[model samples]
Target: MPVLVFGSVNADLVFALPVLPAPGETVLAPGYATLPGGKGANQAVAAAQDGAPTAFAGAVGDDALAEVALRGLREAGVELGRLAWVPEPTGCAAIAVDRAGRNLILGGSGANQSARAAQVEDAALNPDTVLVLQREVPAAENAALILRARARGARILLNLAPAGEVAPEALRALDLLVANEHEAAWLAGQLGCGADAASLHRALGVGVAVTLGEAGAAAATAAGPLRVPAFPVRAVDTTGAGDAWCGVLAAALDRGLPLDAAMRRASAAAAIACTRPGATMPRAAETAALLG
Candidate 1:
């Protein structure tokens, strides 16, 4: 089975500050580093590191930053044959992490806005395929891919990060929908429903998983509701934790794990990711060791 991620890619500028800047306020950092990041790219790396055959389909500029933005995915061995080179600048994210590992991020869509559903081929989607999506790209493109994947009987997982408008028809086409507490609440409001996992599942007619940071995560599916406790770990940077959870969950599902078991693995992977700086992913062995 293969996991396909169709979303954004970016070069992340990370600044470690004592505290995040408030509105109209500026904070000084000792130094900064550029890292490969973006919800989609991080998730693709996570899936590949977890030992799944993963492919990434997105757009990047034909510029110097493109390589930097693709480093992590390339290192993780994710196939990038479907990647596009656009005239627009590569997408970029400015991330500021405070002492508590909390972060504030501002992103420039750039080439990401040019990402299209046509980037992924029809042959890439099937019953054994796990198609992952995120909100960094255009919603219409994501919606189109969802419908296409649904028609091919692929397992579609949409991580509604940076929550935005999505077609009701696309929501109904998903096998699973992942979101953080804030995103979940926003989505609930959009659907005119309660902000709980079960309510979202009922309203959307699909499984819903909500990541609750240190409080762990909860999911609602036709099988029943499930709760996975967060693993105990000292946090370093929490930027890519949710992406790790989504990617690992997709990998687990592709490996034939049940949803409950997949959530457990995802929770463990997320904890491991929080212990690392930047958008780093844990390998399969590291995740298994932590799960034990």
Candidate 2:
């Protein structure tokens, strides 16, 4: 099985701050560092690091920042054959992380807005392919890809981060939907359903997984609800933890692991990511050792 990530890529500008500033308040950090990021790219790296046969389909600018944005994916062994070069500047994210590891992120779409569903080849949508998507790109493009992948019998996983308006048909087409508490609530409200995992599953007619930061994660499926407790670890930076969970979960599932087993791996991967700085995701061995 293979995993295909259709999403955004960005060069993350990370600033380490003592505290996140309040609205209209000014805060300063010692300095900032550029790192590979973007929800789509992060998840693709995570899946590849988890040992999945992964490919990334997206667009990047010809700017110098394009290399910075793509370093992780290339290093992770994610195939970039579907990547396109556009005239827009590469996407960038301004991330401010406090000493406590919480983060505030502001993104500039740049070249990411040019990413299209057509970038993914028809051959990429097959029964053995796992298509991973996020809200970082245009909703219409995602919807188009979702419908195509569904018709082709590929398993589709959508991480509804930074939740916004998505078509009902697209929601129904998903094999699984991953989201944090806030995103889950937003989706539930939009669908006129309860915010609980079971309610979401019922409303969407698909598997729903709601990530609970400290407590852990819970999933709702035909087998009923399942919960996994968070692995105890010292926190450093929580950025990209959710992306790690989603990617690892997709990888685990692609490897034929049951949902419960996959959730455990995803949880462990997320915990490991939290102990690292920036948007760093843990390798498969690190996650395995932690699980053991």
Candidate 3:
């Protein structure tokens, strides 16, 4: 089954600093690097690069930026038949990372907010598809996409990042709720759960994977909580690690790997992503080496 991704695309304008500045303070950086980023686009690239049956359904502006976004997706092997063009400028993110992996970000909605209701209705959905979502798009659009996917009988796999107002019903509807520890805590609170595995599982109905960076990942399942350790690697840039993990996991599941084994491969792929600069994940050869 294919994984259908619906979300945002943004040009990541990154600044590297020796130390990030405090609020109301200033810092200096030597140079800047620009990359195609946005949770949805990054995850789609990850999925396609890892050889998932993947398609991206979203809007990008009818501008030069949009062309670049499209090129990136095409290079990653994501199906772009459903992507549409909007009138607004392309979305953009300003990112600052210190010597450490910590980052500060400021973003603009741009074309992401311009996705129309008609386009939402026209999303080509399939019953057996894995519907992956992220918070980079408008909240209403996200909800609308979820509703449409549900109508089309797709299984939802939501990765809640950059937090937004998601209803508890949405939580219950997901076949997989993938998140980092902090997002898990926030999700637990949103659903009135106690931020523990048991409560989180009860609220989301038992198929939730909580990722804890180097500590690894834990999932809440009917068979009980399952934990997987992270693959150790010398970390370089953690920019797109989470997106890589989410995409690779979705791909592995689509390829029929058992859930635990899928997480291991996902973790290993993410570790490889950390060793490389920028958000693009390692090629198929590198991923195969890690899997081997």
Candidate 4:
């Protein structure tokens, strides 16, 4: 089985600032690092490293950034057939992080924002493939991929990061909704999604996992809300931790593991990811060590 990711690819410019600038303030970062990032790419790398048969579906511009992006995924063992090519400047994310884990992300949609619905609809979707999606692409286009994948009987897990307005029609197609709490709250408000966390699960008609940073996470399902505690670790760069969780979750589910176990394994993967710098996701062996 393959975990197929449908989302953006970006060249990341990360800056370490003493403190984030206020809305109207100007500040300078002491140092910087260029990394291979973007939620889709990060999760794809995470899935592949954590033992999913992974494939990535998205666009990259024909530029140096594109080469960097492709090289990273190929090295991570993700399939490339579904990737599209455009000249619109591959997406880029500028991240400003303070001494605390707080971060502000400014992104250029680049080629990803222009990813078309027609392209997604025309692509072959397999029943056993777990279609993973994010909000970096247009909502309509993301919805189209989910619907098409569902039609082919593929499992759908959507990570609505950088959340935005989503319609009811699209919500029904999402098999699982994964996002941080703030993103979940914003989604619920914008879509009139559900009254509360419990209601949100019923309304969406899918499994809902709301990540709570150090508080761990909570999942809403038929049984009720189940809270999963965070793994204890000395945090390093928290940059790719969430993506690592998503990646491991997708891999575990695709491999026929049950939900609770999957989340725990994902939590472990994320804990390990936070211990590394520059979005370096743990390989299968590394994650397994944590599981041990």
Give the per-residue lDDT digits (tens) of candidate 2, residues 128-240.
99999999889999999999999999999999987998888999999999999999999888889988889999988999999998899999998889999999888888998
lDDT of 4 by residue, 194-282 (tens): 63457679777778888887988778877667777888887767888889999899999989987788888888899898877657789
Q: lDDT tens string, model 3, 86-188? A: 7888888888877766677888879887754345444456666777888877777777777777777777788888755776566667777788888888877
Q: Which stretches of candidate 2 lie over 4 Å from their true place?
A: none
Q: What stretches of model 3 exceed 4 Å from their correct place?
A: 116-123
Clashes of 4: 0
Q: How far in Å is the alpha carbon of 32 misplaced in model 1? A: 0.7
Candidate 2 C-alpha error for residue 117, in Å: 0.5
Q: Tell me which residue pairs clash in candidate 1.
A: none
Local error of candidate 4 at 181, Å? 0.6
Q: How displaced is residue 182 in candidate 3, in Å?
A: 1.3
Candidate rank order under lDDT: 1, 2, 4, 3
Worst 10 residues of 4 by lDDT: 115-124
| Clashes per model (N, Cα, C within 3 A) | 0, 0, 0, 0
